[model samples]
Structure formats: structure tokens, C-alpha cells
Target: MTVNPLVLIAILLTTFTCRAERLFIGILEADSIQSIHYGAAAFSRISDLPLVQEQVQARLAQALLLPAYAGIAASETLKIVQSVDSDAPPAPDNPANVAIIPLTDDGTMIRQAFAAAYARHKSQDAFTLYEAPSDTNRAPCVAVAVADRHLFTSVSRPALTWAWQNRSKFLEAPAQSLPGTFRILVNPQRMADLTGARSAQAARIIDLGRLLRACEALSFSFTLEGAALAVTLRATAKQGSALDALLASWRVPSEPLWHAVPDNAFFMSLGAADRPDLWTPFLGAQRHRLLVPTSGRLPPPAVTGDRLDYVAPTRDGKGLCWVQLLPVKDPAAARAAIRMLADAGCTNAVTFSRLRRRQAGATAIETYTVTLQPPQMAQADKTPADPSLGHILLSLLLKRAVLECAVHNGHCVTVIGPEGAIDEHLPPETFAARPLPLNRRIGGQDPALTPDLSFGGFLCAADLVRHTVTIMPEIKPEQARLLPRGGDGATFGIVHNGRTLTASLRVQSNEIAALQRLNREGRAVLQEVFFQIFANQMMDSKRPAAQ
Candidate 1:
């Protein structure tokens, strides 16, 4: 029997049309899981489209879950989502039929990008990947999905009038340069949207911070500047709109901050602001913390579901960043001390680069604890100092805006160190055999403060201009025993003075013997690497080897 088109519409409405988190299209084992494949009759008409098979499969990418997914368009082929089990349950919710979501905005462009990506996946055996913008009510998107720690992605963006690229490459020695500055902050969400409330009150404060800070920069009024977009958005992670909703439900205060949390909500009354009738939207919004830090280097364990929320700035001056919310508090010291309690269950308190300017005499380390929200913090560390606000913001902006890592060959290599620090200009390690002297200012300031630069699990003191090269090799399971086994298939390694090359190879047919032969040849290459590294170190003796 043929399936009705209305059935498709109902499925679409149930899974694709959701506003909170839409499930655009999906295929499932409608009747059972004893077998998994499409039924012959279910997918007959779809294959007639120019590229339906590829198009339907393209939408399967998980990274596309974000705003970048413009929705799927039907293409050349279709699948018959067939029953999977003989002993199938009477009613199975997972429909095996494929879906096609017509794109409205930038629809054509999205279709083209999808087709091209699918073609790449088929021809190159390249992993599909997507990185959708973290926006809602928007299309022309990108999406990413990772399985077994591997990735598949889909990408789309509106017509590029003149994007970040379009510059000249391969310039002749005498070529005149096009001198220009490119600074664009496109589609930055309101703090409320980006913060996505943990509660109405927290959401309000976060929104206020985002708005006020942006306003302070422009010296423009919110109304006149069109700064705040008032929407009844839920403050969930990503758009992180939960704090607003939670606060609205909790009936938290709306007055200027420093009002203590209500005795009812906060176990410890950290002074907050007064409540208001119109300010009801501030409750119930869940603040999205890096509830889990899944960083690649110091990534919290996949099991440790905690967002590697708190990230130490990438040690060795590489890419690193953290986000937090700061509210005005009573007995300012107590509020500041709030940042110190590791167990303090309040809004985000990590000393963001933006807060540095407001924190003049105060110092906040990026680590987990800083004595913020202290009942009497004004008196403690009355003279402590960290990089100034200007410095902090510049650093924050620099990391976000400047540093970017690109995968080279098989390894991921990224740039670090102060934005434009040159390796050639770094001074030699200032040595002292007896307890290296501390960094001292004009007064009695301790001089122990020092920063570092590193990459690909390597660290150094002086600027090293060379890229931190990484090598990745896919070894089949049986052949993986050749190289030291790593987590799953991942292994951590570095080249030593005697050893020069490192790799994680995959082998499907060969076993350990094949790998041993490969390793034997690698020794010569490793020797060559050591000689080159030794020469570079001799020329610039400041860089200690990365551990």
C-alpha cells in the first residue's frame, strides 16, 4: 500500500517544526530494529529529484543542528525506510522514511552547498562536517556532528557580497600591497540571547551587562541605539536563554544590581536588587554554563559531562577563553568574594577579559577560584593587581578574533603567543643559575609573574616562530598495535632530541608486522627532525622543549 503525503506532513510537524529545538527531518526504524535499511516501495518517488538521495543524506549531519542548517531540499534519490524486526512491536514511533524540508531563505544557496558537500563526502571519503552559526530565526547555516570522535559537517551562508576572504594570494616580490583594515562584528547576539538566562534576575543582569557595556562603548542610549531586542526568549545553552525564564518564574528583583538574592532563593543572602511587576520575565531561564568542558587538550572526560566551563588560558599563549557573568553586589567585597567559593552556586564568576577594566585594584586569576562575592572582600587583597581591563578586553578579543587553528596534513596545528609576537625578535632566556631572580617593579612587587607560549602539547618560554606541526594517521584496528595504543585510537606524543616524527596510523589489512616495518623507516626521518630542531634551538637557546 502507498503512504499518503499527509502522513509526511504530520511527521514533519511533529519532528521538524519545533521552535525550541526543531527536528527538521529524520528516519527511524518504524516497526523494529532486528534489521535496518530503507524499504523498496517507501522511497520510489524521491529518487527522481535532481539530487534527492544526496540531499536527504546531507541533512543527517548533526552539526547542522544549529542555526546554520537552512533546512533540507529534496534531491535525486530516496530510501524506503523499512521495518527492522520480525518480532516488531505493535507500534513503533521511529519512521524509516526520509524527509525533505524546503528551504525558504537562501534556499538555493543552501541546496548548492549541500550538494557540493555530499559530492565531497562520496568522492574523497572525506568526513562530513558542519558548523552552524549559534543563531535562531535564521537560516543559511552550517552544522557539525561527531561520531566515535570523528566528524561530518554541512555548510551554508547567505550570498557573500564581500566576506573575510577575497584578498590576493601568491604575491610577487615587488607586488604592491592592498593596505586595508577589516574589522567587522556581524550578528552579535544581545547579552540576553548569548547568556540565555539561568533565571529571570540573572538574565536581566546579564542582559544589562551586555547592553550597558555595548552602550558604554558607543555612548548611545538603548532606545536611541536599538540596543536591546525585547523578546520572551528562554535562556537555554547556546542561545543560553534560561536564566531569564528562571528569574521570571522566581520573581527576582529588577532594580539596579547589588540587590541581594532573596532569602527564599539564595541559601546565603548575597545582596541583590529590588523586584518589580514588569520584570517578571527574569525567572526560570536556565543559565548555560560550560556545564561540561569538552576541550580537546584538557577536555573534561566524555564521561565527566561537566562543561570544561573554566578553561585556563591556553598555556603557552595559544588559543584559550572563558565566559562568566558578574553582578553588582552589596558590601562589594562580599559580592567579589563570591567568585572564590568553588561550591558557590550562583551566576558565572570567571574573571572575563571584559571585567578587567572595571576591576582596577582587584586581580582575578582565570582559574576556578577567585575570592569574589566576599562579605568583606574590599579589605582583602586591597592591593592585588592583574592585567588592566584594557589589557583583558584586548586579550579576550585577541583570542576570539585573532587566533585560529587550521588542520595541517593530518595533525591540527594552531597559532599562539601574543597576537603578533615574532619568533625572530625573542630575547635569549635570561639565565640565573642560583634561584632565578623574581620580576620586581619599582617598588617591592614580586617578579615571579611570567607568561608562556605552546602548541600541540608543547610549551616554550621565548617566541618560537615555527609552527607546532602535528601528524595523524588512521590505522586499522588490527594494525594499530604497531604504535603505542592511545585513548580509543587517539595517542599523545612528541618528538624528542633523538626522535623526530610521530604519528597515529590506521591499518585495515596489515597487522603489527606492517607497522613495525613502517616504524623502522621512520627512524631516518626522526633523525633528520632532531638535527633540524637541534640547530633551531642552538640558534635561539631560549625555547625549552615542549613536555
Candidate 2:
């Protein structure tokens, strides 16, 4: 056969061109997707749900233009593996349950899916893809044939390729850690760089650079062992001394105040370590005017230790009120300061009178009753008052209600609340003689989990669900329909472990199983319920000033 050299040359050139084009396009697409992921992660750190929603809506709009992309579909079951590594050995325990919906391999479909997953504000442009030269020395080389701003997909080609090539070793790789079900391994230095590139608007809202410097990595794991969810967080600092100083600043009392609260209390928060300076940030101009007058009267005795406990109405139909306990250095000084403020007319219509004294333990407790007059408003001032004003007014009223002070062991416990509620509702013995239910459940786990814990509380899930449904008639049917059966008796705790300042919701075994069994439809229903509750709470808490 006679062959033309020109024909052979043309064929060779065409093949080479196609291969080169694919590689160029792939690299561009990979970089674009990676950038988008980083941007999404940064937005999430801000904790602005509304802004996140806007972003999602914008992405969904773009996805709507793609014909191949359809709306999300329901799935019956979600598989949860320990790691993305294909050849890794099976976990010794039950795998964690996570909500995930995989996408098709088509470029267009993948891009649409990514958009759906990471909806961003309309103002934020979709990532632009452009061809770039590849570094031959880099392992797991990524290649592509075409670039599509709307159709390109795959968040990180390098990561995916690395995982595939080192399937068995990926989980144990030193570069990355995969110790938990929901793991986030962040390079602090890289995070700092990303934060620097963020918009001025975002930077002004949060100190992302400082935040990233405090934490090296975070992991969340749900295990059947003791039927609980555990969170492990790692902190990082440029120097060991800096890390130590950071932890020291957060140190709280060796013991928690929850033990002193009644078991029936519905909600409670106790701070073991007191830093009055921390409240300075929350003291806005209006609050400063109301609480801090020129008279130099000290603010409510620095609650060296404090407790705010609440209880819901009982079956017998008795409404419950919150009781706050503050330990001070000197009760007399605190009393004098309040009296001076009232005399200076800084307080709104306040009156104080002494009450009976009693003996408890090795201490003699003195009591006082304070009354506050309601704000006198003009008929035309019907416009809703500012939420900040309401809060200030409430604080003033509570300060004058009924206060009991008992000094022992170099500290004074100043209890404040309605006299009737305190006398009738508070148990004779404030401290628990035996281990509380939550303490029993937590067992011998590190005391560090509770000592410096900012907030720690436990509740019966079924009871909470029942009460919520009963109080909010509109959500009753939905709650009843969505809540899994047989998990009623399960208990859950919202704990903020002090050491790492990480929060987690720990659910019992039955509830965990129920959560795992939820199909896509069930999950959606639950999510809707959660969304509604969150929306309602946000609305209720909205400040007039913010509006």
C-alpha cells in the first residue's frame, strides 16, 4: 500500500491537538470548581443562613437554564462509609448516617448539581474556567477536553484523582486525617490566605484569619457506643505559648453550676468562669445609657458564677418562671450599688424592702424584695418598642424582684427571681445529693466537658416534641408525622465542651437509629419542621433596631 507522508502528518497533528485541548480544559475546570468550593466554605463560616439561601437561589436559577439538570429526587437509603477510600476495611462499628445525593458523571449534570449544592447570592458570579499549562512533576495530573462555565463540574480533580490512585492508603495518609464520620481537615495557613482574599464586606463581619488560627481541624462522629455523638476539635497557634494563653483565657471554674439547679428545670445555663469584660461588647449605646449612669454605680456584681434556670408549666397547670443565681464577692457592695443607682434615678420606678432571713447549710441568708413600676407610655407611642428597650426594662424589673444572698466559703450567692416562684418552686436542697441524669449518662467522660462548658443541658426528646406540638397547634400534625416512632423516651444533650469550645447534640441509641432509617422524604419533612421552627424563633427574636 502506498502511503502519503502529508496525510500521516495531518493525522498525527489532529490527534495531538485534541489531546492537548482536553488536558488544558480539564485543568481550568478543576481550578474553577476548587475556587467555588473555597468560597462556599467561607460563606458558611459567617453563619448567615439568609445570605446562604440567596446564594442557593441564585445557583438554582442558573441550573434551571440547563436542560439536562432536573430537580433533586428522593432516595430510599444513604450509604455512609468511613472514608472515600474504596479498598479500606469496613469499620468495626455501625457506619455514621449522612445525607448525600450523588450526581451523574456528565459535565453539564455535574455543574448543575454543584450549583444546586452550593447556592450563592446572585451578585456572586459563577466561577470562570480557563485553560492553563500543567506541571508535569505534579502527581495525579488532571486533564480535560473542553471548558464550560455552566457545564463544567468536579470540585477538586486533584483530590478525586489522588483518592482513586491511593484508595487503600488515602484514609491513613499523613497529609490528611479521616478519623471521624464528618471530618474537616483544614490547613490553617491556606485558610489564612483564603480569608485574606475574601471581600472587605465579609472580612469586616468576621475575623476569619484569627478564627482559622485558633483551630487546625474539626471532626464529628456519631457512634452507637453509649448511643452518642462526639465531636473532636484541634486547635492550632503559631506558638505553643499562644495556644496555652488562648485556653487559659477560656478556663472556667473546676465545677459546674448545673448541679445546683433543680432537675425539673426546662432550660439552664451556667458560666463557671466570670469575665465581666466580655459583656462590654454586648453593651451598645442604649444599654450603656440605661445600665451605666454617670453616678459611677457599679454594674450588677460581676457574676463570678451565675445560673439562669427555667421550668415549664406543670401538669397541674402552674406557670413557671426563670430563677437566676449570681455569686458575688460582696453582697453588701452589690446591694449598695443598686440602691445608689435607684436613688440617682438611673433605674425606672424601683423600690426595695428587706425580707425575712433564713439559715441554710453553714450560712445565714438575707433576703430583699424589689418592685418595678411598668413604663408609662403615651397613647400615640403605640409604635412597637425596641427589643433592646424591652430587654433593659426586663433586667431592671428582675433586679428589683426578690433577691436572696448567702455568703459562705468566701463567695456570696445572690439569688434573684419572683419571691413567690423562688419560695414555692425551688427545691429545699439546691444541690443534688446523687448524680444527675445527664451526669450519669455522661459517666466518667472528662470533666473538662462540663467544667468550662458554656452551655450544657439535657432533655427528653419525646417530651420536647410533645410540648412543642401542643403549644404550636399549626405544627402539631407535622411534628407528629415526621418524628420517628419509639424514640419518644430517648434523651438528648446540647453540650459545648470547654476545652475546644465545640458544641454537639448527643442523641440516644433509639433516636440515632430512627434518624438513620429516615428516607429522603422523611428527611425533607424533618428539615422543613426545623426550618419553620428556626424561622419562627428568628422572627420572634428580631430586634426593632435591626429592622
Candidate 3:
């Protein structure tokens, strides 16, 4: 009896739905396992970006050391899931997570990739041969699984059993919702325990136990949104008074100074007033004690009541600059502080004769220009040292640094850089004509992303790459070609909201193909750079001990 087409379609749909549940149920089972420690699952739709797909395919081929993969066209959708078993004892055979990749073409390419991987292991006396059954249905399926120890005995066996028993599972819907191009979830507590147990001695140095106890979990997701790559990190904090104290110490009032930054700056960071006491820990007690003196000819106070801090470096590295804005609570006090700093050799030349005093509304304003002398060469022997040699050459090449300060309207604006660089770029008219203020730029983009206070900065990738290549002429032409050319610079910032802290970084490019290619190849370099930057910031902001 021939079945009606409509009825057949409905039957197929219901069967597929049931099979999908079974697949998801297996995942749930694995997640519930008492010994199971941590796992991550990611799904990617490469078909959306054909160029990216091709690039990934090329990299995978190289990684697998299989030429066949180079010609293979990856499936439109790919999913990878992995888990670890913490309780498993140290042995050759230990259970771990498996990776499931469904392909559109026959499973030949997958088989080749695994075979090549196995051959490499065999050459090193680490290979284990296992005869495994294959699913030879109309659309063949291939599974490549890995374990903490023995791949075939621990991870592959269990994975194959699941695939065989529920053949329809791989053919049905995915096990979970796919949120982004890449996603990761980590159990901080468990990971800490595992790491600490492996190196008990090292744990004493860093105290991982305390940190793990303070953090509940961490989740990270990355996606391509419009012209930018957006990354979001959510960290759950443990409830307690310690967390409260930490959050309270982070709360401070400040304004962003993006408008004051020069257009030629290769990189810049600006943020509102920071507590000088917060930086004492990183500077240490000895340095702190020396910073503030308690005798005649006293040095300026360690904390200058700076309301805003700005730093930038020029593209050619010829100019390094720092700017501090101090709100003048008392005119006499402000003037005394500046004079004290000047007397302590803060500037090479201080000309009180050129000082200008003005008024903005009822507020008093004073502007001063200070010159910093270049380094002097040490006393030469009886025979005068050549001007082309040593410190003499450096001093001759270096221009005298300059510091310009303008105190007005209850605020003091200080800028340090090459002579006249700051004054020429940051004139009153130009500063006032800037289109968007820092706070508005951040809030207007996404209100939810705004934090109590933030430090904003940008770096031009093309300029950075050009400088790097110039310094390292030995870099291969191919590698240099891979670097991104002209594109929108990358922007980064740190935000704090009560107990939570968020860091955001964004890079945009009109050359999407080149940018994606760079991301695929240089992900490790990018990650290392980001980690260093974040770690340095954290160290720099370390709080002082309460007396």
C-alpha cells in the first residue's frame, strides 16, 4: 500500500524530532556525570562567509597534516563538543570529551585526517590500533574523539556506542541552541582545583584557592556584528563582604578625555581622576616613602588632585605625552603645588616671566610654559668625546620635552610632549569643535555597555604592523603580506559596574577578507597581546594597604 505523501512527511518530522531529543539527552547525561569536570560546545556557520570558510579549511588541512583536507569542502554547519573527567585516575586509558563533525560529502576526508594524525603518533611510539565499526548509511558519518589518555579505549569507544545506538541522532536537529560563532563556558572552581592539585607547590605562590572561591564561573562569547568583532565576558562573583569591599574600592568619579587627544596619536588612553592611594601597592612602600618628603624644600604631594589622566604616543615614536587635569579647589594651593614641582626639577626651564593670568567667569586662570632639557652627556676624559658617540649623540638628536599647564575655571590642564606639539594640536577652538564627547560615544553605542567610569583608547593596526615589519626586516614576505593593510583602528576600554567589571575591545575593517584571514592565522598572537595588556592594567591599579 502506497502511503500518502503528506502522512509520510509528518512521520519523518516526528521521527527526526524524537531522534534530536535522544542526542540532546546523551549530552545531558554526559554533563550530569559526577566524574565529568568541564565541557565546551561550539557551533559555526561558515557558509555565511565563504572566504572565511576557505581560510579555515586551509588551516585545518595544515594542522591535520593531510593534503586531502586542502581540497575538501567543509560542511555548511559544524559543531564541536568536548568534556573532561576530573575523577579519572592517572592511567593510559581515561575518559574525556569527543568531537562530532557532520559532513555533506562522503566520510573519506575525515578518515584521511584521522589516519594522518595516527601516523604521526605511530612514528613516536604512541599509537594504539583499534578496529572500529563505521556507519555506512546513505550519508556516512565520521567521529574523531580524544581523551585525556588513550583516545581509542576511553573517548572513541563510548562515543561510537552512542552514535551506533542512536543512528538518527546525528541526522536530526542540533543538541543545543547555537548562540555565536564561538562560545566557551568554564567552571572556575573545578578548573582551579584541577590546576592546584597538579602543582601544589606553585599554588602557594599565587593563591589560586582564594581566587577560585571568589569566582563562581566564567562564560565568553565572540561574534561578528556588522563591521566589528564583539566579545562579551560574563563572570559570576561569589556573595560576601569581601566582594563588596572590592567593588566599593573600584568606584571613583572621573571624566573621559577623548576630545583632548591629538589626531596624530597612534595610541591614547583617557580616564577621570583615579585615587593615587590605589596605586601604592604596585609602587611599593619604599617608592611611596621617597615620593613624598617630610623636610625643608618639600617635594610636591604624592597625590596632585588630578581630575583626569591622559597618555598617548605618536606613530613614529618620536613623541611620548602625558596630560593631567586638576580641578583647582584653591588658587593659592594650586600655584604653590606647581611651583613646588618646578623647584624640584620637574621641568628643565620654568619662566615665571611668561606666565599668563586670565579669568573665565568668576574663576582665575593661569597658563605657564615649561621646557625640559635633554639628557646631558657625562663628563668626558681629557680628550673630549665625539659628539657623534654615546649619550652625546642621543642628547643632540632629542628635542627638549615641553610641559604646558593652563589653570582655569576651577581646573588645571597639563600637557607634556615635544615642544609645541600639545599646544598646536589642542588649541581651545579645536578642542571645543570636536564632535562627540567620550561619555556620549560610549553610551550612545550601547547603554547596557556603559560603566560607572571607563578608560578609552585606540590603536591603528596598519601603522603598528608597518612599524613591526620595519624593525624586523627578516620577517618572511608571505608573513608580512598576511598583515592587515589600511583599516579602521582597534578600540578598547575597561568598564566597572558595581561588583562586576567588563573589558571591551573592538576592531573594524573594510577589508573583511584580509581581516578574517589575519584572525584565523594570528589568533594566538592576538590573545597573548590582549592578556598582557589586561594584566598590566590590573597590576597598575592595585590598591594600597590601609594603615
Candidate 4:
């Protein structure tokens, strides 16, 4: 008997009456896993690097969850149903996951396989249970059962029985055929609610709840052709929701500003804007804090055009610097905004002093120095100021902070760097002299890919690791272990095709290891950074007050 894929999907779409009961359904059509294998095998055969080939094999085997997965025949059709906790956030370490995998041959093959792996077996509550005592005590009592042509596994017997009993609810009469090789649909609102509850302050600060409320469902799909794998993530908007309105208003196409970025730049994010008001969605309220860092409430500069943001290493490759370019619609308004930012600096415990003015080709650049003032101490604790001491402290903290602002070719170009490393990558002339094509750099050049995507960015993985370790030497060893090496880069693009918004991540076959490593270590990297910052703050608090 053959099952209609759409019937299974319809069952997945059904709403549960219990608030705590959550379900996740995944459908893998025939040959899906085989295709992934084929891609990896083709890559391995073509790749010149032997280590990358070995890495692909190891990753594929681990993902399949069996040592001899390479020899296992691909299932004709695979349906996976898991029960999730709606109140709790999803996590990798969640041990409550119950999986129901459809089986072939009356489930006898899988039953025998489980029995061989476990030490005890018995029949209880109309379900055969197999127990595996974990050697490490991570899962002392694991359970597995084979019933109704499906294999169930879970740490909890209650969860297993619940899934077995409600298994019928996830299927119906035959209907339409499945569309993609692999697809998964999730309830975005439920996930959003859990996230909001967990991070109430952060959710409120960014209005994350409201923004995610418009998404009725979030979907992911994957397709592999030859050696290239394309993964797309899309959020289905609710009818008449705030996100619906926002998406409708986002009609501006991101312009091509890849040529503006220097080849040595480690990262780049470029987009286009028709007017200043449209930037709110991309920048949000945090733009002011990032761009100006002033305590004033003055409006942002009136600018509208293509945006080019890039980060590159300093001349000696010891430090990193950033540059931002925005189209200058009104130079006078831009100047006034800068002045307001400078004037508001004093209120924010910082000072902005004009250093000098110089000519860089046809553009006139005005440079400034931003210095962070030391905290004040009580009168009794105050001591005579030592000029050398203050100078050393400032140099160590600010590292010769420099900011250069210029308007060239109808764009407000701002470059911020340390140690006077700002003159090498000046806008217009320098960029024109050495233009870096983004598509060529990342191997993402495709004529079919829309040139006017809503947003696009690139990350040079090797450069990122180098620059990150260079900046924070304390984490060099740990970062080396966490980050992937020997990959060119990865590219991400987002497209809004009138009705739906789709974000895609594309990478070359050689960079597969890097992508996998990044996925595994990305969270660890963030945690390490936060821990370092907290440690530094605690040390500073313990230090004696500067005189």
C-alpha cells in the first residue's frame, strides 16, 4: 500500500487541542538521502583536497546516525513525526524528543536491529519496549518500540505511547503529491511565544514578538544538484498582519555595490534604499546607537541610495576597521546630523574633536578624534593627574581612534579605524582602482540569481577567524578549535518575490566543511565573546581608580 504524501502533510497541518502538545512533521521523498550522498560523493571525487573528502564522509555518516549508513539503502518515502514542548524552547540537547519513523516489512527489520542493540525487551501497554542502559548515564533508561509499521524511540515511555496512540491523527486520505525532496513546516507563533517568554526584556526592546507575530509558519527546504546545495528559509506572513504591510512596502531592490568593496575586506553587507524612512526596518532604533552613539534625539541624516558596508584589516593586519557608505541626498542635512552627533557626545561621556581636513582625489575628507573619558572619582579619592598615565590609558583603550567623513558621488562615506589606517581604502578612487566582484569572490555568480535582491552579504571564513583571533588573542587557541579553515567564503541572499520572501544560503562544494563547522561552533563563539567581556569588566572593577 502506498501513502499519499499530501495526506500526511494535511495531518501535520491539523491543530492540536492541547496547548502543551506540539508536533513537528518532516517528509523526505524517495531518493532524498541518496541525492545528498551523490552530491557529497561527486564533490569528494572532484575535490583535490583529501582532508575535505574525509570530512564530508565523516559528517555524512554522523548525520545518518549509523556507522554503516553509506551501505544502507535509501527509503522510498520517509515520514518523521516528533512531539515537542510548546512552552519550552527548542534545543539540541533536549532529551524529550520522541521520533516516529515509518518502517518497511512489518517493522520486523528495525525491531530486530533494536533488539540486538539493547539488553532488555518486553511487552507493556500493547507496545513492545526495548531498553538501553547508557554507559555514561546521560540516558540511563532509553526506550524503543516497533508497532503499526513504525519505529518509535524516546527517553520517556509516556511520550512514546502518546505518539503511538496519536499517530493516526497525522495522516488522512490520499491527496496531492509532495513538491520538494525535503521540506519541514513549523509553527512560528509558538516558537516566537516561547522565545518572548524566555527573553522578555530583549523581546520587548526589539519588538521581536510583534515582528514575528506576522509569521504564521516558518518553512525550510533543501535541494542538491550535483555538488551545490541550496537551502531556503521562508516565513509565511499572516493575512492583514503588520509584516504583510511591511513586506508590501519593501519594494526597493538592493543595488550592486560589490565593486565598492576592496578585495582584502573580510566582510561586506550591501543593500539599497529609496528613502531614509525605509531604513527603519533594516536598521531599526539601534541604528542611532551604532552609527552616532550620541545621547541626542536628533533625526537620522536624510540620505537615500545604495548602501555599502565593509570591514577590513588594518595595514599591518594587526587590527580590524569598518567603513559605511550611504547615498547623500542632502549634504547640508548630513553635515547638521554629524554636528548634532558631535555636540551630543559630551552628554554621553565622550568627546569628538575635529582633527583636520584633507583632499582625497576629488572628495574632501574631514577627520575627527573620538575619545572616551575616564569615570570620575570622589573628591577624597582624587589624586593629582599624571599626563603620561592618562595618555597611556587613552592609547590602550582607544588605540588612536580616528573617524573620517566625506561626501563623494552622492554618497556619504564614513570610515572608522584605529592607528591612522584610514587612508588606504578611501572611497571612489581607491575602490575604482581595485574593484572586487562579490559573485566571483564567493563563487555565487549565477545569471538566474536576481541582481536586485533585497539584501545580500558575504563572509570570508578564513579571514574572519584570523581577524577574530588577532583582535582577541586570549581566545586564539579556543577559536582555532571552533572555527573552520581552508574555505574561501559563504554568500547569503534574500529575495522578496512580491508574494513571498525567501532567504538563501549558497556555498561552494569545497566550503561545505566550513559551513558545517560554523553551524556547530557559532553559538560557542558568541558565548566565549560574552564570557571574555564579562571577565574584563569584573577585572576592571577590581582595579584601583586611575589618578
Off by over 4 Å in 3: 1-97, 100-180, 190-213, 224-226, 241-246, 249-258, 272-320, 326-409, 412-414, 419-433, 438-453, 461-486, 510-547
lDDT of 2 by residue, 127-178 (tens): 3222221332221211211121212222233323332332232222222121
Per-model TM-score, in order, reads 0.19, 0.43, 0.47, 0.65
Local distance difference test scores for all models = 0.23, 0.38, 0.41, 0.55
- Number of the top-ranking candidate, with TM-score as the measure: 4
Candidate 1 ranges with C-alpha deviation above 4 Å: 1-547
Which pairs, if any, clash in model 4?
Answer: none
Q: Compare candidates 3 and 4 on lDDT and give the better one.
A: 4
Q: Highest lDDT: give the candidate number.
A: 4
Considering summed lDDT, which 10 consecutive residues are worst modelled in model 4?
63-72
* Pairs that collide, model 3: 254-272, 255-272
Q: Tell me which of candidates 1 and 4 scores higher on TM-score.
A: 4
Total clashing pairs for each candidate: 111, 9, 2, 0
- Give one digit per residue, the lDDT tens place, for model 3 in 112-187: 5555444222221222332322322211212333322111112334434444343343334332221334444445
